[model samples]
Target: MPKDQVLGPDAIAARLADLPGWREADGWIIRTYRTHSWKGTLMVINAVGHLAEAAWHHPDLTASYAWVEVRLTTHSAKGLTEKDFALAKKIEDVVGWQPGLEGGALEGTPSDPRFAYIKHDR
Candidate 1:
């Protein structure tokens, strides 16, 4: 329950089950998001930055022309903790959300390849 408590392997694995593309690697929970181009990659990074800043729990992100890998670990705890999992869940929810599929006013970006952004996983 405490933020400083380190999670064991089992706890990490259990938490990762709810996160589709996230995994427990070494001492962090990580996920790599595939983007359509450099622009999409920057968008993902910026979104993650805002979330991390708001939560006050930053993550290490590796970005490329087409992908961004998010790695979260609780620095204060020196290992995986609730902070890592919480931020990871928030990142996943925000990054993977598709308002268009919900059929609301926001019809999301065009599905066409010419205007597509992040390649949402099925």
Candidate 2:
């Protein structure tokens, strides 16, 4: 594909093959990063925002106590573009992400059954 051009379905699929946790969804490429705590989740979100701003390509982000879902699309191009993929790659790098690293569905499960976990001193 040409530099910074909007990618079609085939090209998007090919590019997505290399992006482990990302998937095509409703005209955007999306991924959810799971963290062990709210603090970790916020850390990831803020890092993404910084990277997006630095790259001049922002993504839609949704955050919860332990997870943040990122949806990337080029609003100017009206579809996916190389910029989105580039930003995703940068975010993945700084976040130290691995596919399913948070253990999938069992992720964020508290060690204590009471769900009243305490933070440890740093």
Candidate 3:
């Protein structure tokens, strides 16, 4: 597929396979990140906001006290495109990172439920 081509359902489905927890709906690829508290919810929203700005591809987000719903599409292209998929991947990586699991110097959020932020999918 061309770099900027608007993707059809089949192409979108194929691309979505590489991105778990994301799905197509009404011409947009969407995902909901579940957080444990209002603070976590705000953190997700802000993280996504920074990522979108950096990529220059914005995504619609709906939030509650415990969850954030992210909707991505190429508005200028009038459909799902590479931009959407790219941004989705970035969002997933930043929002779902677990440093402790990566065997790095940085320890992730504590194991105690009280310290847990995002409800990571298992």
Candidate 4:
């Protein structure tokens, strides 16, 4: 679908509810995962790579030693769309991980020292 004809917030939210671990940001959907190490981070990237190729949609990705950030937006469409949301949902499902119950805890909160050293790229 053309990005110009992308879905609105209401449509995006309806679909997003079905996709766990995704949150809205600047009219786009984003999800981040914390891995044990660089190897685990690459594993997540590889998984997302396959998904993006299969869908013919790409996402903005940032990776560190223990974290991978994925931001989905349809640059061609100039905003969010069903395609972006679909990809975000697929990533969340296939990654086999979810954010912590508390906001930003899994990403690394003071209480959880396990992932405290990891840094995410925006």
lDDT per residue as tens, model 4, 5-47: 7787788888888876788889778888877778778888999
Worst 10-residue stretch by lDDT in candidate 1?
Answer: 108-117
lDDT tens per residue, model 3, 1-122: 76568998888999999999998999999999999999999999999999999999999999999999999999988899999999999999999999999888998999897988899995
Go through the candidates in order and give each one's C-alpha lDDT. 0.92, 0.78, 0.93, 0.77
**Judged by TM-score relative to the true structure, which candidate is superior, 1 or 4?**
1
Models 1 onward score TM values of: 0.96, 0.76, 0.95, 0.72
Q: Write the per-residue lDDT of candidate 1 for residues 1-122, one digit (tens) a residue.
A: 79879999888889888888998878988899999999899999999999999999899999999999999998888899999999999998899989899999999988888787799996
Least accurate 10 contiguous residues by lDDT in model 2: 113-122
Model 2 over residues 1-122: C-alpha lDDT tens digits?
66567888899899899888889987799988877678777878888989998988889999889788899998988889888888888887767643234577645535563442222221
* Candidate 2 Cα misplacement greater than 4 A, ranges: 1-4, 97-122
Ranking by TM-score: 1, 3, 2, 4
Q: Judged by lDDT, which candidate is best?
A: 3
Residue pairs with backbone atoms closer than 3 Å in model 3 (clashes): none
Judging by lDDT, tell me the better candidate of 1 and 4: 1
For every model shown, the clashing-pair count is: 0, 0, 0, 1
Candidate 1: C-alpha lDDT: 0.92
Q: Return the top candidate by TM-score.
A: 1
